[model samples]
Target: MTTTPDDLAALLASVESDERDLVLSTFTHDDAWRLGCLLVELADERDLPVTIDVRKGPQQVFHAAREGTTPDNDSWVQRKVRVVERFGASSYLVGLRARAKGTTFADQHQLPLQEYAAHGGAFPVRVEGVGIVGVVTVSGLAQGDDHALVTEALRSFLGR
Candidate 1:
């Protein structure tokens, strides 16, 4: 089944009781949408320009933009996949992996461009009772803040 953007929010909105608990408990913290919102909020808080990409693959499941976001030749969807792939590869190339059994890879490394190009991103998504299923990636921000934005969003959205 295709997971539409509306599907995610509406599903989250209607969730309740043990059902909600089951869903929220599986995440290590940040989920994709929360991360996206955090990027926006951070952009506002810091007076920065950012474009957040939350994708499932080459396809962008969610894209959030703040004022003054630059349009790079590389679109958000492409960057999301690269971040996930680079992060995933660090495991084999460098013997790195998530400390937690199924939390995430230790965050992949990427070159930070001043304004364009994909910067910091994440690749770990929590699916409630389903456990970690995919990644929640964001680029076009400071590396640390980029990671924090995603993680913080996850924590806030999960209400945990």
Candidate 2:
């Protein structure tokens, strides 16, 4: 689908709003597990083929792959996680910011494609005062769908 500048602006605003509003009081390994499970349930309910990953710092706390996912989905999750780790923003937000600046994410940041991806599906796990503690990522759908799935799960998990 073609994204008009207006659409991009609105999406960017929504992602920024999510980052600002979805702060957890605290995030723990248990919290990651709960969040990860929520994501899986949401995807499964919709019959989405996706791989989900939740990381606490450098340690992966939770992971799940739905039946239709391929190994490539895992790689996408990792790459999207790197984007969140490096930028402390949602992967979709990073990509939107790049587009807003009239550049591709890789070229704008000079990041290697194999190591980082500024695509949708990865979101920073932020605690109220602790900043970004980890990432929650999903892959296998269209990038925008992946992002929406994660955000929707976050909204549900956080009771937003």
Candidate 3:
């Protein structure tokens, strides 16, 4: 079924709290690598042509498996990451909220559309009480699919 804005909002509410509750005490490069590998493995099992990116602040620890993906997918990843970093929330959630408020992210936040994307597939890596530390992103699928894939991977990784 196609996800509506309300569905997206519900998803955001359900997952964001879990994400906050499941934060790592200390997120390391090894953690990023493992998470990235899990994302890639899951995507490959589904034969998805997606790029997986795991970043800690400005440092990208893992980026892999861009099968059937283009440079545009990389750009989408960066844009989605910008949205997550700016809002400290999942990119899809942000977009859904924007739509619910009857505005676009660029119009509502006055951010350049070229720089920030409110599309899916970018999730904040919240470090327990430390707040947002990084982002995990995937691209090259429908926006909701991208978000769902990352969310599912994170849930499995966090054992939530």
- Per-residue lDDT tens digits of candidate 2, residues 76-150? 998999899888899999999999888899889998899898989999998886899999999998888999998
Which portions of model 1 show Cα errors greater than 4 Å? 1-35, 56-59, 73-77, 85-119, 128-132
Comparing 1 with 3 on lDDT, the higher-scoring candidate is 3
| Reference-based TM-score of each model | 0.50, 0.97, 0.89
> Model 3, 31: alpha-carbon shift in Å?
0.3
Off by over 4 Å in 3: 1-9
Model 2 alpha-carbon miss at residue 30, Å: 0.9
- Candidate 3 residue pairs that clash: none
What value of lDDT does candidate 1 attain over all alpha carbons?
Answer: 0.47
lDDT of 3 by residue, 6-54 (tens): 7767876865664565576778999999999999999988999999999
RMSD of 2: 0.9
- Scored against the true structure, residue 74 in model 2 reaches a CA lDDT of 92
What's the true lDDT of residue 25 in model 2? 93
CA lDDT of each prediction against the hidden true structure: 0.47, 0.91, 0.86
Better of 1 and 3 by TM-score: 3
TM-score leader? 2
Q: Across residues 1-160, which tens digit of lDDT does each residue of candidate 1 receive?
A: 6646565444334321222232344432234455566667776888866666664434455676666766651365354445455544211112112222222333332344232223344545546456435556555665445555665665566666
